[model samples]
Target: MNYYDGSFGGMHLIWWILWFFFIAWIFFIPADIPYQKSKKESPLDILKKRFAQGEISKEEFNEAKTIINSAT
Candidate 1:
């Protein structure tokens, strides 16, 4: 039982490196995957998008904007 053996310390260091790599991969790499849930758009943001796309008219956008602003 030679505690001074470098192989034991080397293996322990390798295990730590492996664990750190695994956790970093799990947390930092999956955000851009297409199946991940995206943040929900705010109501005002949706309204603005619709107005820009011509799905809603200026009057409708203004009314919705007013309502959303007042509610918040």
Candidate 2:
């Protein structure tokens, strides 16, 4: 049976400090990081924006609308 004596107080203090840091890291760290902004956007909103910017022709927009409707 062996045990550390009180004479090594500095070593004990360092051990305590390390243990405190380890526990703090385990218990206080967040599991999921928060997003700055939402990434979710409805498909309709994207289609409307594209249509308004004249990026797609009316036929293409209707095709996209049909695809979106079918997907949902």
Candidate 3:
């Protein structure tokens, strides 16, 4: 109610813009961050684990490993 003075006091447009983005980040950032992360195992790494665990013989492992390497 102090319009005679140039006092928007605590409510400026820039502050509103900043608060909009800050509140948006509080709600949206964490879930979006997990999707942005590379949480997948590489083909070579998976293959090595399989070989180590005796899921595949050395010959099969080497063949699959070669194919994985060449494709990348």
Candidate 4:
């Protein structure tokens, strides 16, 4: 009805360390996973993407880019 063998050879301590390390990683990692929307792109970057994707005309892109640059 007991578990302690008195000779774990540090395995028990290693398990505790690994458990804490996993918890730290879960909380501290940024999770920069793609398609997860973990990162936010700046306005200019979004505008560039729009232009490249043909979602906006060249002149429109230029105007928006100018506005974003001046605002910053």
Q: How do the residues 28-67 of candidate 2 rate in per-residue lDDT, one tens digit apiece?
A: 8867675656577799889989999999999999999999
Clashes of each: 0, 0, 0, 0
Higher-TM-score candidate among 2 and 3?
Answer: 3
Q: Model 4 segments beyond 4 Å from truth? A: 1-37
Residue 37 lDDT in candidate 3: 73
User: Which residue runs does candidate 3 get wrong by more than 4 Å?
Assistant: 1-38
Model 4: lDDT to the true structure: 0.88
Tens-digit lDDT track of model 4 for 8-72? 66878899999999999899987686468656798988899999999999999989988888999
Please tell me which model should have the higher lDDT, number 2 or number 4: 2
- Cα lDDT tens digits for candidate 1, 1-72: 766855558778999999999999888886576687889999988999999999998999999999999999
- Candidate 1 local accuracy as lDDT? 0.89
Q: Where does candidate 1 have its weakest 10-residue lDDT segment?
A: 1-10
For all candidates in order, the CA lDDT equals 0.89, 0.89, 0.86, 0.88
Better of 1 and 4 by lDDT: 1
Residue 45 lDDT in candidate 2: 89
